[model samples]
Target: MGKSLLVLENLSPGRNLDAYMQSVSAIPVLSVEEERELTERLHYQEDLDAARRLVMSHLRFVVHVAKSYSGYGLPLGDLIQEGNVGLMKAVKRFDPTVGVRLVSFAVHWIKAEMHEFILRNWRIVKVATTKAQRKMFFNLRSMKKGLGWMNNDEVEAIAADLGVDAKVVRQMEGRMAASDTAFDAPVSDDDDSAYQAPANYLEDHSADPAHQVEHQNWEEDSQRRLMQAMGELDERSQDILAQRWLSEDKATLHELAAKYQVSAERIRQLEKNAMKKIRVTMEA
Candidate 1:
């Protein structure tokens, strides 16, 4: 079974997917007793042959799971291969004493691998990153009521169903609708169309002299206004504000309280009042 299984595993679905599917489909599914025996051998005895047999008997299940993900626009053969990897992992970790069928247990591992593969290759930029976003990415298509963009009601419904924010649902929908555009125009594109590439329009403003001068002026003006506001405060208030905020070593409320011979609560109140005055002055 080991040698034969290895040969079957090497059957590149990319080369001939039909033949590969046929081969996997022909491998007989194990009965409950047979499955348990094989799983026990692999789990307790560390029998490699038993593991191979377990994986072989379940290859058809991997195919069945992979086919459902065909709408992702990835190669079906690659998806099946990924699912096969998951199946092998499931077989390796399966505990026969758990009292569950292998197919039922392996489904999670099978879909996990396929999901990872789809996320990795579906777009040049990843559409989903967080756990919530990943969940929405996979299910958003099915939940959508129409081919067009989802309305507010639909968005709200999907958000409630998926336990995510309505804004997040809209964001995921936008990401899904977006197609990857090359940074640079294709070489075959003529001058009329070449400027349409993101490379042409997404200019770097950081190095622009006029923009730099404007930012510097704004910062200097803000600093001047802040300093003038601080000058308007009494000497003690100025020191408190400076030590608490502008100083390299900031003073805690207790430290400032002790220095000023006031209670910590009094220090906090003074600090709050000072900040409020500063904000009013700055805004004025």
Candidate 2:
């Protein structure tokens, strides 16, 4: 008799990977005859249990494929889970009439999901994208052994072998060899050797505490000077400057001209002169 359906439902894939694998592995693989029969049932009869058995039997194969992608630094469990999902998709779509093994058909879908996961999670800076770059990201690592840097001949050879441009190979090579460096030096640099850190030579004046404070004071002083200069103007000038320059509902030259009963050209001249005076006062 088949295993109790209720007992099988208790199985959690994440509780223990080993237990999950062992349990799924215990589901007998279909023989050629058995596979044909079960696949036929799933394909035509739409039997859910047959689909379940077909999926369960292939879990070990998914684990095998997941292991090959171990260098990507993503959690193996997550990769396996993604692969399992792909496997199910394959099972659902498998045609028993075509007469191919389920594992053979599922391999493409399983790797596709795992590849997407790796591309997303592998690094903050995405090293690879595009169909060609994706091919290079995985294979190029293996090609680069003993790395000071690949010489031009080596780059050309790798490019030729991989069916890609030499320039692309050079770019991928540079990305792989590169490492992230901090903008500031570490706190523990006490010796003269600490001068080697990037922070010593590449100074950022904008980030300096003293400079930042001075900048704030200068901005405030400029604003005060501008306001003082505006105070020197007549009431009409003050209103024009405030409404035309400062307030949220800014007054245009035409609007100010209509209000003061002058040509738009005259209003434009007054506004320009006011800006120049403000600049001179602020500089002083």
Q: Write the per-residue lDDT of candidate 1 for residues 168-220, one digit (tens) a residue.
A: 89898999999999999999999999999999999999989999999999999
- Worst 10-residue stretch by lDDT in candidate 1? 1-10
List where candidate 2 sits over 4 angstroms from the true fold. 1-16, 25-58, 73-75, 85-109, 119-136, 142-148, 158-168, 178-207, 249-264
Worst 10 contiguous positions by lDDT, candidate 2: 1-10
Q: Give the number of the best model, judged by lDDT.
A: 1
Candidate 2 lDDT, tens digit per residue, 1-284?
A: 15633343566556667766666666666788887888899989999988988887788798889989987667788898899999999999999878688888999999999988888877667778788788898788778766578888888888999988999998987776665566566778677767877877887778999998999999998778877998887787788888887899998888899999999899888878877887787777
Candidate models: Cα lDDT each: 0.90, 0.81
Task: Report model 1's TM-score to 2 decimal places.
Answer: 0.71
Task: Please estimate how well model 1 matches the true structure, expressed as its whole-model Cα lDDT.
Answer: 0.90
